[model samples]
Target: MKSLFLFFFLAVSAAIYAQSASTAIKPKPSYCNEPPEAYDSRKNASAVKPAALPKFNSKPVMEYRVQVAILRKTDPTKYPFHRSLVARYQPCEEVWIVESKQSFRNRQDAEKLRAELAKMGYGGAYITTLVGYE
Candidate 1:
């Protein structure tokens, strides 16, 4: 009976020693191949200057409209036209575009106005689209 008790005590001691030795937390191994110099977060953030953003000078767009005339150098209003006419400066083409104030939803309406403008002695008047910036 005494020998059996000694055998049980030695078995319990071995098990307790094995569990305590294996419980220690160890550092995990890294698998990443990239260098850690680019990812360091300990540097001062304010010392690094951010890149400058590009300026948005204009937002040019093209749309269908009834073009009445194209003027250069002088103002568009100096020419003979109705009060509803609007002149838009096109920087891309470097010219002033004279068009009707009333926007047409479809191409047929713009063509009708263009025909009328042609009959009004504007022989060069035609329907065309131009990109302009405001």
Candidate 2:
């Protein structure tokens, strides 16, 4: 009798679960419903003109700096010009460039530093212009 009651209880539970599942609302998957005019690029191309390139201020600004050395490797601690000294790596040239930390407004100031550096071991030191930090 218990076994029959157990079977009937399972049958009723399954029917109730099935009826609830069928009545439950299911969400439908959304799709891109774009119009045919938007999909047609060629027809839209005539309506949309190409954007013009932005204009930049072409005025050139010049600054001078005394270049101490250009080497594959450099030790900042060993550099003689400890005051206001900076080193930058040139990836294209594959070299480490050592220069003055600050730019001199006048070429004469840069030349003076180059002359002093030449007196030291850095004989190849020269005055170089940094064109827009190039």
Q: How many clashes show up per model?
A: 0, 0
* Model 2, span 23-132: residue lDDT tens: 44333223323434443355547766666657676755688998877766444445555465678866545566888887887889888887876776668877888665
For residues 1-134, write the lDDT of model 1, one tens digit per residue. Answer: 99999999999999999976764333333533334754335466576765555778888665557777777655665567866568987654557788888766566877888888788776676777656564
- For all predicted structures, in order, the TM-scores are 0.44, 0.49
| Model 2 score (lDDT) | 0.70
Candidate 1 residue pairs that clash: none
lDDT score, candidate 1, position 105: 54
Error of 1 at 100 (Å): 1.5
Q: Worst ten-residue run, lDDT, model 1?
A: 25-34
TM-score of structure candidate 1: 0.44
TM-score of candidate 2 versus the correct structure, residues matched by position = 0.49
Each candidate: what lDDT? 0.69, 0.70
